[model samples]
Target: MCAPKGAAALYVRDGLRLEPVVHGGGQEHGVRAGTENVALAVALGAAGLAADDLADGAPARIAALRDELHQRLAAAPPGCVRLNRPERKRLPNTLNVSIDDALGHELRAAAHGIAASTGSACHRGNHTPFDLARSLGALRLSLGRWSTADDIETTADAAIKSATER
Candidate 1:
């Protein structure tokens, strides 16, 4: 399902030159020069249409569930659970957090019913294997159209329980 050549489009303001991040490519003003992939573009458009077909209130419902989970998890002691990217606008379907004194393994084991993942992308590839050793408290939770209130409650309970273990 991967896109061929990995197509991407950028909008640069007139007269504004955004230096190429990875120089040397003889195409698109010296970028990852490659032949156009019409099939890939069609697949991407189909995926976009599929996403747009979700229920009208699906996004709002997902956001409410995310917020509920956040509230439940953050009800712990001050400084216990910290939200990632708090100062910036975040997607309504995702909630990432780091809980103080919580081991990644501990949380994982306790949260058997929740499909939560530990460690953030920003912490990975820093010469660390999964970055779980250092980011033991981090948990990247994603809410989807199928997620329910009960799932959110269970997730929060598991996280809070694990966080309190240490």
Candidate 2:
């Protein structure tokens, strides 16, 4: 609930008069009127302010942890785990991989504490074409502000073990 991205700010271009899908007696002079989630709006504003105050190096640090996790997982025997895309093109905090001889959902279940989903996060956004049409042997790992080196180590070990189980 603390994550306020669900309903946040909206930007309309200058000289653009857009029509709202829902027209009712509401806020903003009744232009697309609806009851707003006041609490969520306040939390979103607070989160934005907090984000602006974050250290410039925070993203880089998280990316480093992401890279380290990939490296540790890659140390597994060749072909056991495959990086689906080059890191340079992806969001620094998301890693997408496919395990040999195993399905993505299976890997997810076997990895235990790791929280992830089958295929890449891109799959949900239509960025990946092969996941649904084939074996679905893809996994997406997301790292964030709270991720630590120990978390990376544990994740890598668990994923490798799960993949190598064959």
Candidate 3:
């Protein structure tokens, strides 16, 4: 499912002049059929405004925390862990890594109290693996607006503990 905020922003940005494949009323400004989801639109607009307020500092802060998390996770015993993506090529606040010989879902489940996913939860564990991708077996940790250094620390500790356990 698309994030309401991101979907709305993409629409507002005219990033891609989206239009319904099937013709319909002027709903969603003709981008989508059926009546407009006014409540969700308004909420998305509000989220956009809130994100704008954090545009300057949030990314850097989150990146730092993410990097710290990566460092901790990377320090896992020997060949037990590996980052799934290049740090420079990824979004600032996302960390995707796989624990060797461990199922992503299992690892995530073991990392108690750490909110994370093994690819898309909707995929039910069917993850796609590219070159270095871990298929659906990489734990995806995303640091968001309210994530903190302490949270990263806790997550790192939990991940290490979980991966080491297997």
lDDT of each: 0.71, 0.76, 0.75
Clash count list over all predictions:
0, 0, 0
Which residue pairs overlap in candidate 3's backbone? none
Off by over 4 Å in 2: 53-55, 120-135
State the lDDT of candidate 3 residue by residue for 69-140, as single tens digits: 888887776666778777586788788888777788888889899989876556665534574435546889
Task: Give the least accurate 10-residue stretch of model 2, judged by summed lDDT.
Answer: 126-135
lDDT of 1 by residue, 97-142 (tens): 8777676667777876887777556766665544454466678898
lDDT comparison, 1 vs 3, better candidate = 3
Clashing pairs in 1: none
Please report the candidate that would top TM-score against the real structure.
Answer: 2
lDDT, model 2: 0.76
Model 1, residue 128: distance off in Å is 9.1
